[model samples]
Target: MTIPNLENNRVKLSLLDLSNYTHLESIAQQKDLIYYSPSDISTPEALKAYVQTAVDGYYHKNTIPFIVFDKISKNYAGSTRYGLISWKDKVLHIGWTWIGYEFQGIGLNTNMKFLMLQYAFETLEFEKVEFRIDDRNQKSRKAVEKLGATLEGVLRSDKLMKDGYRRNTCCYGILKAEWPEVKEKLLAVIG
Candidate 1:
């Protein structure tokens, strides 16, 4: 149940090679992806701290994050990851994902997610993949739904964000048994 740090496939829209801090810092500075309404990353220092946290997490193998690159735009669009892996349960969570505003609704996420799901199911042999989105994030909720994940439920007071209050989280997931059909549907929608 060892998940590789990097999973490459033809469908990958971008690869976030975070082994280099400068690259990660540069990608984080791109405002489009980092400029969401509720986003608290206003300065380079703040972004660096955030990237450092992610880097630390990845280096320790607790989290794996990647940068999203749009082949057409030839620019880094955002970041996504495999977090909170439960090897014994054959489960993994893919959340804390963000795509720049320009890349939204452009199939970039679909392609990236397709690659991730393939790697998780085929390579890591995970039984289930989950996404936990902020309850207030309709865009994310819709995107996950479009990816063919089922909304499981909501965890009230799930966590505290930079804004200093507990945020409710909406859970969505697709099991191994559902991936075939789900993947097909996703391809059709994105293609």
Candidate 2:
């Protein structure tokens, strides 16, 4: 489970593991971001399990997760990942993203996404990158759309939330052909 460290002028994406639980827990408590996720990481034990699941996913080839770091502030902002990867299809899903409330509205998300898209499209040569948002998460839906991802459709009852309710997922995608334009747009916004 060697997750590469990704960086740019504004932020860094470090490989997340059990060792990062304390930092992640600190950020998790200071923000409401984790409320939307299926994992309950509010406590030390829960955070450990949450990270272990992600680590397991990495070993299973189901995901590669990263801890979002703000380079300028030198603080942990949140987390994001490349999940549901299909090497044969040259496609990967990017979701489970969250930025601490204090860091939201800044350019961290754009910079992080930019680095990821660059890696997925240029380095890995993925043909398409997908994003799935809970239908009720308007903030997430807007953020994905802002990245120039086209709305594909909805997956009814796609996931079970921590609240014991099924969540409808809104699917979005950005093809390699659309990367150049999206990249340009992101650069402008990130700047």
Candidate 3:
């Protein structure tokens, strides 16, 4: 899959690959930021392996991950991805999102989501884009809701977390028909 480089005024989202391993690893190691990350990226070797998994997923047509870059600060903010893509169903899932501790509470997450959502809805013409967050991650749930995605429900014991616990997944989604209003709301906040 050819994941195009996406950028807006505030942020740039580039495809995540092996070459980005070191840079992302450094960001992942910053001040407990990796706690919520799906992979154990605390060390360089572990981060390299994680990146390889994402790259392999891309080759297998299962996922397209991106490195989030802060344009104004000219720094790597974090990472996010479009996973579980279903071309036949015109649907996709967006998760595996992490913003370094320093970058949190700013509008970087909002801007990043806006760029991805716009591309998913307008460029890819997907009928639906989904977000699944660990039920315990209140911050992520709130962030996804702020983007105008409707919470569908929760999937209990959906997957095993890195901590060795079965996590309940909170599911949310934005449909194509709802994109216009969502886009407007996102733009309003981004402005």
TM-score of 1: 0.82
Top candidate, metric TM-score: 3
What tens digits encode model 1's per-residue C-alpha lDDT throughout 1-72? 244444233233333443543444554555545322234444667655656666677666666767665667
TM accuracy, model 3: 0.95
- What residue runs in model 1 are displaced by over 4 Å at the alpha carbon? 1-40
Error (Å) of candidate 3 at residue 6 is 0.7
Tens-place lDDT digits, model 2, residues 70-122: 99889998888899999899999997787778889887888899999999999
Which consecutive 10 residues in model 2 have the weakest lDDT in total?
27-36
Model 2 lDDT at residue 34? 64
- Clash count in backbone of candidate 2: 0
In the order shown, the candidates' Cα RMSDs to the true structure are 3.3, 1.5, 1.2
lDDT of 3 at 96: 82
Write the number of the candidate with greater TM-score, choosing between 1 and 2.
2
Judging by lDDT against the true structure, name the best candidate. 3
Candidate 1 has an lDDT of 0.71
